[model samples]
Target: MNGSYNLSSGTHYGSIGTATCVTGYEIHGTANIMCDNNGYWNGSFPDCIPVDCGSAQTIENGNVSSTGATFGHTATYYCMPGFQLVGPNLLTCNASSEWEPYEPNCQGMYPYAIRK
Candidate 1:
């Protein structure tokens, strides 16, 4: 597999191979297969699909831009005119099939007026 998948056992006949997706990915097919007597693998080939974390959670008084929710996808946080980003402004789908650094929140602008 092009993705990072681990195969258990060898490819010889009568051997059983187990396919497991790496962190941040999900399996889309049979996770186990047996080697047939004809030197062919039995069962459908497993595929590792990128994990989807879904669109960024709605941020109060802010908007998020995402390039899909699949692994390796990125989300950028933006606050409304009067709000400020309270945490990280960017997030990426990481291993363990979750977003790293958690989601950020928007906070109201600084309470006090600024003096030059």
Candidate 2:
């Protein structure tokens, strides 16, 4: 388990147990298990999948790109020609399935002037 498990009745026979995922992960499969006469759990463990932050948003006169949006990933922002980035250029995917440091904005530096 990538996280922790809680057992009721102190692992005694006929006790119940549940699996919980830590931050940045979601549980998949059966989350509950029953204790057997051998004082062990009777069900398979669940999979803890990483949280997804979905796709990066696009801004006018700018482009947003990233290799992936899962936890611990980064999104890079680049302004188009004649525009300027108004904030941080990078946003990282956090444990809560959101992008941190906020998304930047693209401002019109010069309508016709080339950006260097």
Candidate 3:
């Protein structure tokens, strides 16, 4: 269960003003969740941007997914062996209501980019 969040307005108390914007997933077994400001009452931190998973894609472990500005967000992804993840390894809901930036890369290797 790995996740990342951005601190937004508030004093870490239970209220609309206090919320942490989450930008990652909390995958627990068959359940995949994205944290939002809803955690305030539960004493969970919120993020700057509301975590909204628009679509789902499947990818194996050791893969790379990239996206452009058309995609609302860009993410780095990874998976486990034997099992596969169903969703963009790195994804963002695009302006056209499309999960951009990519279709998902499958393989076991290093994901790096060379500066030209």
Candidate 4:
């Protein structure tokens, strides 16, 4: 979250660039800066914090249960009785505030099989 900015040796003025943060962390302020007419860069560096994924969506014929709505958190899927889960049962919130591994679906399972 906290770090220092390094300037390459022999750097000249009027240079513009962007700042970046490590995974699972996000910038909390301006991410771009530029060297002024002077020899110094403008604006202070931003801080990084844990990414936050607001919430999960409700799946068809099933329910979504989550441990937390942030980075590294999990969202679990559940199907009702006689229903079949068509995809993965778990999704994780990533650094981009998104649930990984696409959402799941619930398909009805009949009690008996029929054939011609």
Candidate 5:
């Protein structure tokens, strides 16, 4: 089966129609779309790709940080104590298809001993 379809940004739609199997060419839209033979969408089905965090921000000054991620994917940051993260440790794609400011994790005070 086929019908008029309108896909908005950051949205993915797929259908097998009335057919027993869905072909790659059956689905159509301005945005990326895919249909499996079983009539199912794949991982992150309609995930928005992420952009790289090329710039670096300074925190407490223990380790350097950079942003790097793709849509439908998450990025995590780790640093030593006393040195915190000034940016988001986790970012998710919003309905607008944009990522929120990186969450910053400020490092806690260092301990006297290496092992607690």
Candidate 6:
């Protein structure tokens, strides 16, 4: 849904191409397709499924705000009063089905860093 796909050659009887999802998305079906002798694609058209990074973990002394875990979605972490956030505070689902910049942790304002 994020982008479009292209074929390597003409849509002839023996043409072939690779179906790939754009960045921040993923393919849920076959990546390779071939034009068959019957003037049809060998397989069903692939679907560009949104990448899922799953749910964010609970952070001590902090709160997480996420629209959704699917691709193109964002998750932001914020520390409560008297606390600070460590690592990247924002994470976005990427095409590889992972969160960008990794997940962050929260720590007390006046103590050693705590990872959660």
lDDT of 3: 0.45
Point to the candidate with the largest lDDT.
2
Tell me how many clashing residue pairs each candidate has: 0, 0, 8, 0, 13, 0
**lDDT scores of the candidates, listed in order:** 0.80, 0.87, 0.45, 0.81, 0.42, 0.81
The candidate that achieves the highest TM-score relative to the unseen native structure = 2
Clashing residue pairs in candidate 1 are: none
lDDT of 1 by residue, 1-116 (tens): 53543445777898887777766778898888888999987988889888887777778899999887888888899999988898899899776557767888888876987889
Per-residue lDDT over 2-116 for candidate 6, one digit per residue giving the tens place of the 0 to 100 score: 5465776988999987787777777787778888999988876788877788986668889999989888788999999988788999888777778887878877778767999
Candidate 2 residue pairs in backbone clash:
none
**Which is the winner by lDDT between candidate 3 and candidate 4?**
4
Candidate 5, position 48, lDDT: 24
Candidate 3 regions with alpha-carbon error over 4 angstroms: 1-54, 62-76, 81-89, 109-116
Model 3 worst lDDT window (10 residues) = 25-34
lDDT of 2 at 25: 88
For residues 1-116, write the lDDT of model 5, one tens digit per residue: 32232333323345422212122112222333445556564432232223333333434544433343323344455667565566566664333334555556576665667765
Clashing pairs in 4: none
TM-score of each: 0.80, 0.83, 0.27, 0.66, 0.31, 0.72
Task: In angstroms, give how far residue 51 of model 3 lies from its true place.
Answer: 14
- Give lDDT tens digits, candidate 3, residues 30-103: 22123345553343343233234454454545554545332266655666664454546666664354565666
Candidate 2 local Cα displacement, residue 113, angstroms: 11
What TM-score should be assigned to candidate 5? Answer: 0.31
